[model samples]
Target: MTIPKSVFVVDLNYVVTLPEIDAHIPGHVEFLDQCYEAGLFLASGAKIPRTGGVIIASAPSRESLEAHLAQDPFHINGVAEYKITEFQAKKHKPNFFD
Candidate 1:
């Protein structure tokens, strides 16, 4: 089965130092959890080897997603910066589901 095709996409770059990734973990978890509970975040994590983070979610529009993203702890607490782009996607196997 294919996953639904409405998601908020974030390309992330860290601004905070290594020390802060550790310090920011708790707040990040809390805010991210809030996002999850609100049905905002679907899949999220670092883009392998810790170069950056990516968040996939559902939102009605770019503006709506941006507003939600603006409240994320990483953004609010200055741990990372992000660029948001809205997407309607269906990924095939290897990329996701076939």
Candidate 2:
């Protein structure tokens, strides 16, 4: 069976302090890079107050996406809780990828 493409908005809420979050940033970034290389992540960044972060990604299924997210250092270390919302990307600018 062919899996449909699903877009997800991953909202990360810090469960620990900022210093704790910082301690794992390098690993988190490495994970993000891997996701990007695999065409799973579109964009990602921290919140204004550094409380957490957000990631825009696409996956074949929610389960698979969740599995991939579980590999993040933040998740592994229990430093943050992730709230994932799936949405349909019906349209986009022609140059949006540029």
Candidate 3:
């Protein structure tokens, strides 16, 4: 089946030190779980340099995506800033489109 929603790449850049990020990890993880359950997030993980993280998601519109991202604990506590990029998925492995 084809999904009509737009794909987004959420880049989280940490503004504070590692301790602050650590302090909010629990809430941040909870937020991620909520996003997953809501079908907003497809995948996510920390950066190799430990600076921040990235999230692959989909939304009906940019406005809606920003609204949902605003609810993240990292955003709430100003621990990180988000840069959202929208893109088209032109290719994938077998069954990826299902």
Please rank every candidate by lDDT, starting with the best: 3, 2, 1
| TM-score attained by model 3 | 0.92
Q: Write the per-residue lDDT of candidate 3 for residues 1-98, one digit (tens) a residue.
A: 47545888999999999998999999999999998898888889999899999999888999999999999999999999999999887765555533
lDDT of 1 by residue, 1-98 (tens): 64545566798888867678778778888888998888777788887767669988777667788888788777888778898777667553453522
lDDT of 2 by residue, 1-98 (tens): 22236889999999988888889999999999999999898899999988889998888899999999999999999999999999977776554332
Number of the top-ranking candidate, with TM-score as the measure? 3
Candidate 2: C-alpha RMSD to true structure equals 3.3
Which ranking of candidates, highest TM-score first? 3, 2, 1
Q: What's model 1's overall lDDT?
A: 0.76
* lDDT accuracy of residue 59 in candidate 2: 88
